[model samples]
Target: MIASNSRAELMQSGLNLIGQALSIFDSDLRLAVANRQYQAMFGLPDNLCLPGTYFEDTIRHMVLRGEYGPQDDPDEAVRIRVEQARTFQPHYLERQRPDGSWISVEGAPLSQGGWIAVYTDITETKRQETLLRARSEELSEQVLENAERLAAANRELAATITALQETKRVVTETQARTRQVTEMIPAHIAHMDRDYRYVFSNRQMPQVFPGTRPDIVGLTGDQVLGTTTFAVVRPYMDLALAGRHQVFEMTHEESGRRIRIALTPDRAGNGVYILSTDVTAEVEVREALTHASRRELAAKITSGLAHDFGNLLTVILGLQDRLTHAGLPLEAHADVQATLAAARRGVELLERIGQIAAPQGTALAPIRLQDLLRDVVEMAKATVGGSARLTLNADLPKERLMLDPGHVQDSLLNMILNARDAMGPKGGEITLSARAAAPWLELEIADTGPGFSPEALSRATEPFFSTKQGQGSGLGLAMVFDQAKLAGGTLRLSNREDGPGARARLRLPLRPVRPQMVLLAEDDSELRKMLRQMLIRLGHSVIEAASLAEAQGLADLPGLTVILSDLQLGDGLGSELATPSGPPLILMTALPPGDPLRDSATGPVLNKPFDAATLAAAFTQVTHD
Candidate 1:
């Protein structure tokens, strides 16, 4: 693209190299383009030489300066010339200027709604022609006339060629600009011919699908997309080739991303234009919204039933109590008591159902993720017992995140139990893992059992949709989905790629605990200012320190978040602040990872030249005491 621009600039430079002054004006008589020679020849101001300058303005300036010799009415002359230019035509002409010099004006209309005019000084040529006519008696009147006409024709042809070249350049630039605009769109734009070969591409395919090639023009679909992906898209490609446009979505196995694709069939040719967008995040939000809608619908349906059922249970309980008190046979008394117990159980169940149906606000509080995961593991193991073995993989940086631990634990337990049931009586291994996919905390549980069926995959999160064959309430996953959406998160269901198992992924926003005050320590004044701003941008009040000694003194200040200091400070080592007795410390270092000083730091390390995001991450990386 840079090369293309450079070549375009070079072409403009080439235009100025011509001796003849040239200018192209659009149909509206506004200057479309002009060469340097044109400005120089007319001695026009820069603004007049620029594109969008009115042709009338240039003509008026010339007329007022007496360039066309004395005019009785300069404005009238300008108006007449402007009107003539409005209906411009191809022509060739020579006229003597007020300076007593002759020049030729040859013009041709452009194909794309414009006309190009070229001006060349013809004083020397005209003088020679006059000399020939006066000095040579052999020269006939007819011969002189022919000679002049030939010269004029040659000049017109040269002007026509120059106009065509400018027209081509304009068209190329327009196309380049259009292509640039298309590239800016956050989607893969491409064109495929009837042979399933990419003929044009905007180089966004690799971004949409992680492993795909970017320069895909002239490559076959399978070659660029790989066998698996091409297979998924071939059916749609066939439909597009059959002249039917299509818009659909498919999960990319390689990247584990969801992409929405639109194929537009060319009306003039057997080709298809493809626009594919990586809509993974968008799909997650859509699913969250869909789950919320279903929950709303479930609440609406359950509200009335619960009300009626509660009143009916009350009537049954009253009768059972009456029977228990009244004189009756011993066996009959046992039956009355059993009936009373069943009625009470029904009332309790109704209350639990109501709690599930009603919306609940999120309890946002600072909590350690490691503590949360430990509690989840302990609870899950007690339930799983010997039914299945449990494995936990937690890869996380030290950080305090905001979450509702109770609700989150309940959701995890639900998923674990479901995985246990799916394993059946024979039992299987259940692996639970947690990691930061940034912007999201991803908690996943997988089991060594048959994966979810197609029907189950599509309807699993819907209320009253279950796969337990009447043994379950079908609301476990629904509740999990509800909890996620309430906290601005999402739940995804998939099969494990490595083996036969089901995977339930819960993603929550990775919001770390934001402190009220942050202490920043750096030796350099410039870097210190930058770090202070970063802390302020993260909504934390900052206290500055120029050395480790200064940082240690302020580290114990009340309400301090942490001491963010450079490892190699002027006075002392920043590593000393990482002591258990001091506040949480995060070290920023320019030293490489292999350097002993960097590796020896007893806190999270932030490499030098980091941005706002890195600073935010560093805050999360601090291990709270």
Candidate 2:
């Protein structure tokens, strides 16, 4: 503390030695600090020179002493100076005092809520300028008047230049701030000229639509967005340039992301302002909500009916059991048996209805297509048996996507089973292929079986409409359709135009995660280091924080791709650091899957001791969603 005091005194002494006057005022309008030259230059009294002196008092003193030259109302003059000081922005001006001295005053606001002013005595400079002007009188009257006019003009120009410089400074600052804000937004904000070339961008095009270059200024829309996507948006862009503002959505093909785009015409009609945001997650949430609402309504409609039907089936089964036990003629017994089979089928149909009406909520997570397909194949092999073969043809750049693994597996499995049934005992091959369809993951299941009839084609997806007659419930395709719609996807059935077989196509929204800069927060030093290295190997830049506080401190750092943190930190739960507004977050933990901390996390979770691939896949899933 003593050493700090000595340093402060030394700093004050050095400031006082400067030839010009300097004073700093606090936000409360009192002198916080002043150098010795400030008092000497202003001829201020001792009390006014000390810290805590009110700025108004100092100004009033100067006014009374006529330092600002003769004024009709001294109080009013003092009031003006005090008021101006209250709103002190950076300024520079030279004024002559009543004592025939000139001083140039420059004042600027401090970052911490106050103002600091520097006053330089320019008496000699002003005197020299005056002498130079006086010497011009040697010329004739006309020349002297012209010379005076020129001098006046030069003064005005200097003042105008100063004002222009200030204006330019402010405009530059504002533009910089605007750029910062736009870049920080999780969208692309840009402008395109009449020629359809980008004139400016906020460097977020890649974030909104991955694989697009960020430095896209001077690039045409087609050049930046590729042919297919550009074609989709060309009409909208044209309309905007024609003075029609538009807002629409499109699937960005390159990244498989759903984007909401807004275009507004410039006032001059020479350009359009564009805003495109990735709305994949929002669309998913909306679809889930819609599906939930439908389920609720369906439940309301089916609850009582299902109960009555279940009871009737139970009674029929009991009566059939008694009839079978009480022997009758063989033909009569066969008919009773047939009736029992039909009743059993009705029971199965009721179960199917229940499954459809109360469909489970989708638990979306990052899943690799290859792994999911492998699982599906394993599950379907038993159902397909030796008579038929299931082949997978997967051509996808990145296998990871945000999806409900269970729902997708179930849907695909159902399709496989349906294809098997369609092939009958002769059993032909079933091919399942996965590929990208731009903003959608397309899974095509084709069977080398008799194609659907015209009537079947029209109502294949309808509930209880089956070609298998009494052998099929007809709800298989319907259930697949429901799953796809619930997942913001589509399911379509058609005859394979290339061959004598049926084809079922499923298209689900694909959100592939990209590499990102990760903030890794973990209390264990070894674990943090290990995770950081793993992330680096996975092509992500990692910033490490030991606790929640440290992570929060680094949260505002720019270019953070995501936050990967441990569930438990030195300070508190790392989940507290998660926010809705910024990059995606993934929580890592050793807790069991059922643990509240793990189960409750809304973001992705990586179990402890995960490998590089697992970490990368988790990040990809979270970011893509």
Candidate 3:
């Protein structure tokens, strides 16, 4: 609105600078614009000179004031001129007013509507022509006067046309720039008409909702957003159309992305403007933080109770021992034993609660999934015994996965043990399966047993909510849930739909040890600095070494993926830093293929003059012994 008003002010200022009187009428036969000279020349009141003043009213005022001339009936005279103006045709006329002043009016029709008229006082020019006719009878008086007036009108019309053309060009360029800026925004920006039909759109809708159309102009909200999504936002849309702005969020079911929408009503009551952005990542982070805070509070509460609870358990155990030594009766002895067992179990439960609620940093490393699975199966055998058969199905990628081996193995065992217990004495087949889910590693353990009850399904992950009668602690599922959360993954418990059984599935983020730590060993300062930059750009935390001795010292540090070294070190060959039980070694050299030194290098060697692509490719070969 500010920009529009500024432009209008600029145009008015320019029009007022013109010496001739000028006025422009819109298609509605109302004044759209008038210069200061126009008002002064006609002696029009402020109301008649303002935009939206009807042409008939101005004409009637002029007729009443005898600006044109006295008429037999002024009303009829005003009506005839008003009707003529409505035709909006090109015209030129010269007339003398009641004040004995002559003026020439030249009007040209506008393409959009109405006409623009420029009025020039030609009384002095007429006097010069009359004098010339009297002084020289030989001259053609009528021809000269007509030629002079025509030339003057043509000059003014040309200037007006040029100004209009410039204005049109500026408007066109401004509109194009606005559209480009809107399109560049990440979120969808669009405008709708009175009937909820799209009138303008920046074509960003498809990016927020994958299945929606990008070119949504001309389509109604319901048609563009589909029936389901349209229903979800219809209430907000109605509010905006009713002049109330709204901002809200909803999940786009088809894309499974969280979408935040903002609606602004048009001031003219025409329609609404909309902005929609995908905020799935933001929502996930918020939920994760909220859950973490709750867990922290739980840990504090559990930790505070531990000291008192430990003392109570010790007293109970001492009393049970006293009863045993007292030679209590056989029936009393059973009751004493039961009491001791309950107290011991309570102690164990308190310990488990603290462990599950406490926060722990994850230790991630590159691991061979197959080897880990083998180890888990071997360990689970002791828990399941000979009654149940353990089977493994892995469809994982060949690349070593990044994970905390201890936590993952512990979680897997927890699920497997739960499955074993669920199957009871009838011990059924338990399948441990693994697969890749892109950014995540998916693992599932399925057991052939009675499916989970509805109530168990809902509360299994909650601490101390066991289905087992008095024999279970119920912390197994809760521990698994925490491990997954710590790893920024998820765990789900569901009964198998195929048959009578239950399944525990886990998904952990697929990252290479949280951006692999790189130990760059190079003797040359300049070369080492260049290599470090490349490593950092590849999302690695780089630790630099200037010599083989420095490299060896750092190699022992944990979490290093590989030792990237120059073949020639200041003190010794980089090959000296290589060890059988250490991080993989990658050597860089400028030597040619035939050089003895290059051939002597056992580990992966990269030609020194290499780009990031070649440097990155050398990492794939770091699996070398």
**RMSD of candidates 1 onward, in order:** 18.3, 20.1, 15.5
Pairwise TM-score winner, candidates 2 and 3: 2
Superposition-based RMSD of candidate 1 using all C-alpha atoms, in angstroms: 18.3
Error of 2 at 292 (Å): 1.3
Kindly indicate the candidate among 1 and 3 with the higher lDDT.
Answer: 3
Ranking by TM-score: 1, 2, 3
TM-score of 3: 0.47
Q: Candidate 2 — which pairs collide?
A: none
Per-residue lDDT for 1-625 in model 1, tens only?
A: 4586687577678777777788888655767677898998888888788655678999989998888989998888998988777777888899998888899988877654567888888787777677677766766764577577768967875786666566557754675586688888889998887878876788888889887878786589999999889999999989988889899999875455789999999764548989999998888878767766776677777786987898899899888888888999999999998888878877865664555577587765556788888888888898886969998999876756767787788888999999999999888999889987666788889999998999999889887788888777787887888888788777889998898999999988887666657788889999899888877766678899898888878888877757788889999898888767666788888898899778777768888888765676556556322
Which has the better TM-score: candidate 1, or candidate 3? 1
> Please, what is the TM-score per model?
0.53, 0.48, 0.47
On TM-score, the leading prediction is: 1
Q: State the displacement of the C-alpha of residue 444, model 2, in Å, after optimal TM-score superposition.
A: 4.4
In the range 194-239, model 3's lDDT, one tens digit per residue, is 6778876888999998878886766788899889889999999998
Cα deviation at 371, candidate 2, in Å, is 8.6
- What would you estimate as the lDDT of candidate 1? 0.80
